[model samples]
Target: MKQMEDVITIEEKNHIDELTGLHNLTGILEHLRGHDKYSASEDTVIIYINVMNFKVFNQKYGFAGGNDFLRGMAHELKNIFPDELVARTGGDQFIVLGKSIDKEELLDKLDDFREAVHNYEKGLKMKIKAGIYRAKGTEEDPVIMVDRAKMACDDIIRVYDRDNNLYTEELDKRNELRQYVIDNFESAFKQRYFQVYYQKEIRAVTRKVCGYEALARWLDPTYGIISPAVFIEVLESVHLIHRLDIYMIDQVCSDLRDDIDSGYAVEPISVNLSRLDFELCDIMSEIDKCRAKYDIPKKLLHIEVTESAIASGADFLGKHIKKFRDAGYEVWMDDFGAGYSSFNNLKDYDFDVIKIDMGFLREFETNQKSRIILASIVNMAKELGIHTLAEGVETEEQYEFLLNIGCEKMQGYLFGKPKPVSEFVRSVDCSFENNEEFDFSSYYDDIGTVNFLNSTPLETKSMEIMIKLPIAIAELHGDQVSFVYANEAYIDFLKTIGAENLDRANEIGRSKERDNASGFANILKMAESSYNQRSEADLVANGYVINTKVRFLSRHGEKAAFALVSRNVTAQKEAHSADDYSAVLMHLLNLYNRIDLFNEEGTFENLFLCGNQKALSDIERKAVVAVQMYSDTHIMEADKERFKKFFDITTVHDRIESSGKHYLVDYYRSALPGDEDRILMYIILPFHYNGKWRFIAGCRYMDELDKLKSVLKQIEST
Candidate 1:
């Protein structure tokens, strides 16, 4: 009898867990396999318990404390079900097998376990999640049953506020799908089953393609099409997301190379990076390698990091983002308002663009709060000097709302859905006309600053003055005048005309009689002519004798955009014809040798020259050229540096800010042949409008102004 007892003790030692004095995984499997009550009975139940955030507890206490906690948990489980088979499977997880009981009774037992855990330390605040699986039939392998229970437990583990879950067939299906993705991910990646799709990012004001975002699509042979939502999470869990991210970068670079080699105009393409990408590899080095391999420009490839990613690991992500930006890649913050710490993230890191969360647009029509929040976000981003892009803009109403709120960029199905590169390239008009060089940065700046619905006034008094004026932004393509935006007064003017609404007015603008000698179309035609001349024009339309002033805004290919301001002048028109005075004033202005206009940022607004000087005529409409042209060409060698210093575009803003001055004046000696002894006056007058300042500068012989002053003095004496 003593010898037999020793044999039993030795056998039991192999089955027992050293730390908890409970059955280990191997012991549990062997016991279940031998016990017919569990292996063959359909009434048996398996419960898997996983301690959530045990690492926190383990770190708070030492490993020995973690062992003590586990042993205590095991003792509690045994006390709760003395007749059941209880085991400490592995690493803060335990398994219990027993005869099936009522689910409510089992839930009561779980509640008791939770209460006991909560009371165990009070300071620890650790929680345990359980997965319960009832046997459907005899299992060939007990390990499969254990895994199924663990899967169900995992479902609850990820979800806060949930302590217990029941195993279902769907869990099995999900497990199988996860396994499939893991098993075939490498094979599919090498076989070229993964393709990159491009979704266009549009300039909100111009409705032109500015860039694209690269999205991954899996064209699996067996699964046909696996949603990124399904596979991305699985890959992230398995730490394989870095491979997919690098693959996407390589694919995007390859496509861009193809486009460049084909002589197609390519825009910047942004590739998304997972947090795992940074942890698992040197993602920046990998991206640089791919870019160099394809010989792609750094500006053409952008990096997108999610707001949550930054919020999760801010210090780590901030370093990576700085590296990317230092390498000349623009890093954009994706899903701006999706998380609670959005403003915190913005404050903590630098991002070139913030993609407003799609949820705002999705609920735009139904929720009024969304509009308020979205508008606030756009305004805040603008004030911070960060660009804003609205995502999921899928309707005309949404697009119009975003535009009205001054969102700079947008992307969604309303513009174009994500599609394979082959299809996307076909849809876009890649053939760009080699038109005269234009300042696109200035154009985008103007677009971003304008919000007709809520325009920023130069002063409190100017708000009322601006409200009375009718303003609009019109895009002219041949004879068609598409109103991209119109103020309330402009829309009201459309009502005064035969057109009842803006849509009707645009239809009339697009009519066959657009070239008529009168009406809105005639005004558009006048604006078109003015755009060609690169000057503002006085336009007359039929209704109410309205006076319109149009100035060139921007141009792309054959399309030109104009900003128009109109007012009803019927009373003034009946009293006098202002056209005569305007013509006389235009001729008077032509007396100047050179005139140029630029915004506060030193972006050239307009350039006018009255003389046939080859050097002056050849000057480009750029800040540097406009500021230095006269000094370089016509000023005396001794005065050239002085003239440049006095007319420096860089110091203009600071001078204005410090002096509260509206104009700057400088006089220099001329270097031109036959005008060597002539003194020229360069005058710059700063004009404020629509919450911005523009400098209108003119250069003329000082003698002309002296002669006019003498004439005025003579007239006064008479």
Candidate 2:
């Protein structure tokens, strides 16, 4: 009898985790099964707890320290929930089964567990995330219940600040998105939904397109173009991100090859390689294959090694980076100043260019401390003989700040957004190839004055003239000098001074045949009678002096007409007219060709007026137009409500205000009107105008906003 008792005790010992001295996986499963057999209460719940970044802890503290940490966690769990069945399910993961415990009670216990783990030991600190699933007697399988708990845990992991998550039907629905990605991963490659897009790095002072950064995009038939932010990590977790990286580089090579074939200038493009690529395959060989296959010039390809990637596999990354440099590829340290290992990695690695993380700009806009750090980084990089590339720039303020700090290369919405191969090719040719090299002798040198005046509509001709210069024009019909047409610049000026539908007002004034005509019409008739055939005047209005030129001529089979040209000269009044506001505005509008308005009421709208439409950009003008249509007519009430919530003006204002000076708010309009969707918009800091605050918003549909958001989340999590 004694021997048999000892044998039973030994058997029980086999069911326990050796390191934590808790119930093992088999033991916990059997225990739950036994409870089910005995008709356990429906209130029983399984709580799954996972240690965040356990691998990092293991790497830092070694296997023995990790085991100690797990042991301490198990001890804390046993003490906290004395009556519950606790088990060490796997490395840095534990399971707790309790009867008659509600969600709040489970959450409280998990919070205690998290706190205890954080204080466990000097080298054993960890953040634990818990997922809870209440059992429904024998209706649900114990294994499946545990899985549901794990799924909830996974969801909570995304929200770094939270430690506990309750399993719900909604979480299961989210799982569908994940499963869809996994199911369609292979097809995404085969169908060529994965595409290569490029965002050029431009010289800060010259505003010249100098280099291109290759980015990946997925065009899913069902979901449209899925953001890499949504799928990249999933692929990395499933060990498939390396394949995507290779595919992205290959696509970029193909595009470059096409550019060369089509006689477009082939600028060097930097391809980002996942850290897993180095771990899984021969990265150097893969790159060589791409260059050989495309017959790409050695200098035409650049290698961008991310700071985090370097931290993870320093030896491999350092070796490969040097090899890339040796092979004639310009190697860049991407996302500089983004992580804890930033300076350390910089000290260890050799790079041709240091791509300053856009987060600094976001931070600089919000935190005064970030500006000092940014300036320091720029100065240091220059001292080290490394060219600095500032990414995520969106506003004139940021562009000017970076240029002032001597940042060599600038890449962001301010310059241009990333574009697909077909569109990007045109953008590259237009921006960089308009001349032998970028001409910065004059900001408007590339913006040739519109001279193609032909059989075009008056409105079209007016727009062509307005966009190319600071001058506004009004075409008048008859001796009344009635407004038959008005350019956008003039319309904008009228709108600025509480004027609405000046064209309609002018048209009404033009109708002298009407019983009730505007007084302005009679005034225009008197002016026409008094003035010579051509007149010039310095008409001052609203703090701006307009150099007005009027000429009477008959053209395009029209009667004698008055052509009024008004050039704003407000910048001439300022001390620094060299940095003329109109010239600055033109440069900005030229760099990125989209206009957005954020009103005092916090209502933001896309105007879709920018540089020439011939200048290819990533901004989804179709989406902007669709949203504008909806805004105009209120077609989708639900969408309007959703947008109202997303674009909560008060919240945005508060956040921006907290930044002290101002920062760029990077976001995306993912669901748009047409099949092609997801436009990136950058909202600049607001300025107090009239009685309210208004913002000059811009768009860069490159998906870089998604990348920035992901980077910020990672920074917050760590």
Candidate 3:
């Protein structure tokens, strides 16, 4: 049987790079335009892979090693889709394209890429994570897809490197800058220090007022209009952008209230909150204060956010976003048409409105490419029963073009510039009181009825908002390597026993044992090696060792990627540190963890009081001698005689930063340790976990029933 090579006449052909056998970026773009896919379908996938660690790799290894690793990975990728592509756009990365498939398959293939690439590793290890998405039907352009991929890849790579302690050094440098912005968010914009600007969204047809989008404008003290992209990126690195969101919400709320009080027709201000904020569920109650103080309607204060907060894959995103949506605040999806994964976000969320990034709207008139995408986006929104909004409508051509394409509404410079809250209020025609409700309310059909009584708001501050940092994967190279994705154990260690390695790669250090157990370094190396050979590894470096069971990730038997399980070592690390505590408590804990103490006599024959309580007289030691009688929640006394140096008697819980663990310290002098000169009595804190008592010893005494005999014996001994 003969197979046909389907060929269409290509006026111009793209030359793929010879070494990697991947298409040059120019070739990829040409190919995109040559194929009708970008002009036709709502489902083409475009992903760009950028080698973030390429510089580090080249510096560590020779240039040849870098190329060899990339080429090998490229070869492995080539085999994944025999008919598709593994085009090298140049440098250490490449581009991949495939049209229309199951979304699950797309994601699985990405996972496989992460796994199989390790198989093709060259002499030096090299790995790259990519951002992926379904192309915007016919409106898709190569550059947009590539940028989206870069952004996605950057996000994943950041999280990935975080696990291995790679980005810790950079983060240290960012802390000062982050703090500066955080402390200045409100005041920074004051005195013309920073300015708040609002961009408006109008009704699709009448071009009337919808609401304004609030953006941060840094009126540079030293410079002017400091690039938002650059500074904003820096703040994100330090995780302080949340403060910016807080500042925006607070200022806008106040500004709106003032305008309304002045007899101005100002509805609630629409401010964009970050996914980080929405997920914290901390803004509701705070907003409520502003709502009541300003006499503003909760519904008027619209929170514009990305779709992720509504239903991102992250463990915490959905529940938190619901806090706002459930409370009766408007939640919108901004930059609706920019990213490839927008549809998934749409499917996952209950969005009141969608704002199409102006980029696409600008191109809609002349670019057939934009027309295809705009239609796809508009049509999709129509089907989902969500409203359509095209942002960045700078030209009449674009506005007219959007309408022709079935886009119901648009916003861009052609209409007007983003004004101040007062100016915007003057611009809008509708009054907040008279308006029944906006069309965006239709998304609530799934939300059912909102109960005002049952719903209470969250605690939010103007600058400080509480958030649970989800555990992310971190990686590091060089000697001071460790996990920057600090979990409880890691943070506990930092708080209890501070590590003063200023040059420390990350907060979570790789334990000495991880050298044998194979920590994040080995995990990444295993993944890198996958790009060349089908190899596996299980080595440890840090104390928190992991059995990174790995296999060469390959497509059709060729090494293309690598995948390994990220075993959580939090519990193991804590358990391993048991011996690091006070000798007495460690001894007691040692006796406690292994054997059942239910039947054994709790009192010790030779009671030797040691530590700070040695100076305390006999009677003072009695409080230190506690009996552990209960199974959970220990009762301990404030013993000051012996353990006074570390914790005052009044302090029941003293925080120890060494292991980042909190300690419930019970300090006192106990004569049982012979004359109260030798030892002090200290009972450890105990909490129930997994149907058993987990202990933090030498800190506080547990006055449970189990220790009653020991308490009596100690009293007699004293």
Candidate 4:
């Protein structure tokens, strides 16, 4: 009998198979709900696994045997899938929601789960195979995720029915092998026993060096250089990915620092980040620490995270991407088009650069559709604020195709192979031959150093910056759209959105009173709004269909003088709206309020408040500092003590108020000796309104009571 405590609500309870305590359809439904929580700038991974021959197993072996087999498989999965959504999507099929677990971990767990199922001898003689596929992301529904995972799982299970790596009963041996790798990994890394190689990207025109991609090389001193394909699989099995990633980053960083400081131009180096690292620790902070230790700028360091890694049915990667970008480093998504939800990933993940896969480029020029796809990729990337770099660009045709489509930056064999630090420096620094015999060193005198640091005739660097700025377009009354001063990025954004592109139009604001559909609606709306009374207002226009942000900057708080800044977050905005916790909270607030039933008036008062005068003073000081971060002021530590000395213990830390309001204000201060100009700079308001955090922090600076009044009035007006 199910106990009273165990009888949970259907939604709250784990969707159980009832006969086996395994995942039911509810798991998939719930996993879909989680997809909405991720940031608008991230993709969610859904691996659908379909159970094979389940009906036959039940018919041949009977319900008891089938149930027993299910229980055994569920037990095996319980440990491996603690954080994942383990849903039995179909009769025997399962869909695992890979929260932030890497693909490698998922593979190993699936293999283990398969093995455990095969070992169920008490149940029946049966084979369990599954296919796994990820979501294509045309839709963000969890059902799509389940469908994809099921497909992918089905593919693997169909051919390798049983007695194979995909499905086996050798659980003990797998565990043993995993443990051995764990034991040896540390020693292998210590010995620097790894194979590190590099692939080069060449310039189709000059035949000069562009850049090289650093590939890891693991050489087992005892057994010879370990293959990355083999060792990486081993690392994944032991769950030591976080450590391995950190090791690679540290090594690359140290190597780059040594080479660059010694006067080598190793423009930038990229290291791959894994799911294990993100959950285990903040990789950005680690990078920050590394940069500080080596005296490196954050911008020089770049890290690559897989699309699948960031799109794991949660906003985990999106937030981390923002954090990394904020810390001043470029973030790139590796293997862009390999995944089905690649387009969704592109929109949601804020990648600084997109490295075009070489496979697409190899035969694109000959195929019309492939060429079109290549062109579209370039255009889309440009529109979305990302620079495009062609990867595996070995052929000159590929390089030419990229350049023709405005994809200038590239990395592959066309440039040069990745070499040791000493070798890379020599390769780029030395002279090279260009078309028909023009040496690169001699050409540099004609093409390089254009008065960058205040020289006379070559030209100014500032002008070069201006050239890159988008050409602005002015939106005036009907049939008068004209060109204005904007940048390339802005121009591309406008073009992508199908905003009418005008050539040779004037670049000035308020030219004949704005009259376009967008401008007219905005201006009229502003006229009808409260912001008309003030000088400025924030306008958040949600273009739901496009999933973009159109922000128009006006004069002051009012859309007066300056123009608007528009951005397309279509992939995220369209999909992200439903995931907003604040929006959800806003909807449920009234119901929650009815349930909580808090009183309007506060219960505490002066003297009875927690902590003594000294404690209150410390809190007040912190509040003052909290507000001071914004205030253009500095209260020296010595000055604080010096001021404290002026008041007696009681006078120094007594509470004050605006008068006649219970639970309204926190501790305040009166004029101190010899410092009458300084008034209380902080207040800890006990009574808070609405749902805002109470115990409010504040600041006040006044000379005299009347002066304070006048100053407050000025603040109120502002």
Candidate 5:
């Protein structure tokens, strides 16, 4: 009896996880190998639990924390399935073997596990995804069942929203296709089966071609045109996507060289880089090599990185993006607003252009929320000095809506679908004449900075406020001024000036009588002067005094673009004297050294600066960078680290939610010379403005000792 017990103990010791005290993979396999118990039972089911983003959690909380988390998960699984055989297979995965369980019951168990995971620790967030696979008694091998369960788990694409999936015959077919892709990828590459297609991006206001995004299409001999959704994901899983990215870069560069040599009009072509590209090789060096080999200008080649790629490996990818930018390549963030971390990505990374995710436009006409979100994204991008481009714009109404919201660029089937380079070149050349004198660089710069919407509250009340402020953006060709965009208020103002709409306003600008009018000529002079200087003018048209401000936006050879803001000052001039207006302006200008306004979500909405302090004046438009700059320049060394922690925008929502406070205040010592004895107080106050929560943040000198103590007491109480 003692010898038999020792054998049983040794067997159990060899097949149990040391950390979780649960059956290991070997133990689970051994149990399934027992023919007497499981071989004849057709009710057996296998559940595979994969903790998504576990690696990121490990990186954040250390291996010891990861072990604790695994152990906790093991405990929860045991409690959830007390009668089943639970096993901690490896890493962040677990397997469970049960009998006679239906699909609905299994899914209910998964939901319970997910809820338990959320409550495991306070302030801890993690995703628990599971896959279910039912086994036939005739299948004796356990490995196949386990793998099928894993495959189902891997098929759950949207990790955040989806919890579990069940394996089916369809998954088996997908598995076969994935395997085929893996086998044929290398041969296909060598045989040049991959082709590069160009999709044109159009300037929203002028409907002219601005650039192209290079997309890859697989022309497999057996399958014909393989869907990128299949091949790209397979390649990424196998860590071979870097090779495809490099191939596309080379192909695009070669195409650009051919187009230039052929005397065809060319624009910047953007190529996407996968997250694996950054992990697998020196991608930047490869891009530089391709550019140099083709002798293509760096500006002609743009780099696009998806938001998921950045979210996966930000620090590593950020360094590579800086290298690309330092080498004069414009980097764009593709598929914006596709994930939960969209705002965080905008705050952390410096992207030249943000490509609004096409999913937002899929239900644009049917969903009011989608329209509001899309407009908010464009407005926020414009405020941050980042260019905005909408993807998947296929309808005239969609195009007009995007144009009205200040989206500078558009790419979709409406302009043209992705086509081969040769075909694209022929189509474009036949459709539009090349402007030999058009300065592409200057034009791109101008359209990139132009924003139609002003910094108003981003809410339902925004439309009301926008209607009250008349704004228009115009394109200037010598004396011919054409209005590209005009809001309802601007159209109303035009009607008051004897013009009905944008078309009529443009026609009046081209008429001989209007050309000789002093008001029209004065407006033109202000626009021309705005190229070198900020200029404003007041003119009487149709018996109303209109105050207009003009700012130069861009120049393309003899053509120019300018943004104009007009307000009828008839009532204001009659109510207040010029001296009162000047006094009001002077008082507002002296309010603060610098003031920044952001939404409750921590997106930078607007900024106002008083003095010409170079350091503060040069801060970037991103909130993350703005806080870092302030900490580096103003806060003392000892307080700098804490100051950063206090000002972290990512934590703002959480802090507000937890504390139920609309404002926060803190004090720190100044780091400037001769200011060692001075203390500065920074306050973040939230107020309801235009139907949204807007935060006004500013720092001021805390001169009075009693006031400083009182503020400190208030902060401590909060």
Candidate 6:
């Protein structure tokens, strides 16, 4: 019997880890199988613990120190949770099983253990994160509990300064969402939820499209639209980013193949390559496969890489970039000046183009320092024998500045926002002609003969003043083909559509249906030769689709002055809404004697509306100061008191506190002398903007205020 007991002890010892003397994975499973899990009256808690930065710890202290630390940690955990199962599940990770401990007690114990790890013997310090799952005694599979704990731990790891987390419904929902993505990613691709949009890059000097950058967008069936900012990171975590990246490359190649087949002029379109793409396989081989499969020229497809990606794998990137150049592909280093080692990257690697980040141009108008820095970067890039592109150039001033500083290319909203490939192709196919005849015989006959060029110098100056008003206006010579004068609005409008001056506008705005300059000239000449007729004509420019009505006036000496009233019809075809929401808000405000719209942060959208100009100015000043300081405590005391009464309501709080809905607060304010006897106001709207909360509130003094109050009451009752 003694010999048999010795054999049993030896077998049990074999199940324990040699280094930490804790149960190995198999032993842990065996121990769990022996538990009367379903009979436990109290909840059983499974904990997953991970040592943070363990790899770095091992690098600094070596494997011997690492092994010693793990063994000590296992012993400490066993002592802390006496009579519980403690096991080394994997590298730098441990699991604990216990019963009867609630969440608060478990968190306290974990916090204490974390602090203990920081103060271990010999000053050997570490930090750990933990996830807890409380079982309801009905679960049969221990693996399910382990996975839940691990998911909780991963959630904690993703956030900073967070140590331990308990599994909750929200985490369960997020896991479901991730699983859906993992399972349906291929289905989504097949169903065409994934799409490519192109943003055009134009030559700064010529203001003509030179290339395009391909951008990916995802339209999820249930979520409507999922931002790449959210989904891409999830995909990267699962090592599936390469799949999406390759799909995007294939789309680019297929588009180019069709464009070439149609015999259209081709532009180099660049696709972004993530660092993971190179890690998975040879990037060049993938590119070669796509190019060969599509039968497109290598030069038509460019490659773009971010600064961080190159910096992380400089040696590999350098070799690959050289291969790209040798194979007739241009390599662009994107988002330059966004990091500290930008210059170092440029020095170490070979790149055909450098794209300056858009951030520098954001403050170019106000910050002299930004201007100086941008100028320095442009000059340095010019000296380095590399082409430079200024990205995010949204304003005319930025475009002109980049042009003057010798930036080879420019891209941003100033040109146009990115659009779907189908829409972009239509825009590219927009063709125009400049040779249509115009006849004004009927109107010219009515004009008979008017004085032509018989105005005094003062009169001419007055006409100039009229033209220079905010409205778009232009003056043409007798021929109406040559521009005599263009007002500021006209010049600005033309520039907005990529035309430099009236001459360029005439050149680019020509269409097959009409000759813009010639048509106007004919109208003026016909008016001059007519009998009491008023001659007129209409001109249209495609692409920008500008429409202008021209009226010809002739003076006594055959000189003609034409007035052109222009409207940009592009907005009618564009996606943004032109309806004035502010007008509706203003009308709502005027119904009350005095009103104000404020965000939750106490910043006012509209000041006092009671015609108290002084009060409005004072409140506006205070509101601006409060927002600048990022504090609600600095707002006027009376305003705070009024707002507090509204926020204090439970229903109102429930609606606006991270609820993504609006609530209303109705209150009364006593009037002063000469004011209305009764004043009722409302702060009934809650909203969020730019990651902050806001509200809309105001009071009105009207006999009909009670009617509006009745309407609001009806809404609430329903």
Worst 10 residues of 2 by lDDT: 445-454
TM-score of candidate 1 to 2 decimals: 0.59
Off by over 4 Å in 5: 1-11, 36-41, 137-140, 425-438, 455-466, 515-519, 527-532, 542-544, 568-718
Output the number of the TM-score-best candidate. Answer: 5
TM-scores for candidates 1 onward, in order: 0.59, 0.55, 0.38, 0.40, 0.75, 0.45
Which 10 consecutive positions of candidate 6 have the poorest summed lDDT?
432-441
Per-model root-mean-square deviation over C-alphas = 16.5, 27.9, 27.6, 30.0, 24.1, 30.1
Instruction: Show where candidate 6 strays beyond 4 Å.
Output: 1-17, 21-87, 94-142, 152-171, 189-193, 202-209, 218-243, 261-265, 293-295, 306-318, 333-348, 352-417, 428-718
Error of 3 at 23 (Å): 32
Considering every candidate listed, which one attains the maximal lDDT?
5
Per-residue lDDT of candidate 2, residues 1-718 (tens digit): 2322322333476787888777787777776666332123577788888987788777888888778777888889888987777788888888887777866777777777777877655655466788888776665566777788898888877554687888887777667777889999998888888888888777554466666899888888898878776688678778888888888878878877887786555566888877888888887788789878999887778788788778778687788888878877788888887754788887898988888988888866778887667777766665455778888999998887776455667899986799876774475454444422312312221111111121122112322211323222243344344443344555665554323556644543353222122222233334356555455565433334545555443332323344455555663456677457557756656444466666655345565654322211233334333345433332244355544443444565566546643445554444444513545454554444333455565545555547878999999999
Rank candidates by TM-score, best first: 5, 1, 2, 6, 4, 3
**How many residue pairs clash in all the candidates, one count each?**
0, 1, 107, 61, 0, 24
The number of clashing residue pairs in model 5 is 0
Please give the range of 10 consecutive residues that has the lowest summed lDDT in model 3.
450-459
Residue 463's lDDT in candidate 3: 15
Cα lDDT computed for each candidate against the true fold: 0.74, 0.64, 0.50, 0.49, 0.76, 0.63
Per residue, candidate 5 scores C-alpha lDDT tens digits across 195-282 of 9988888887678777889999999888889888888999999899999999999999998898678655777788999989988999
The residue-by-residue lDDT of candidate 4 on 113-179, one tens digit each, is 7766677744554555544433345556655545444434433542432422232224334434445
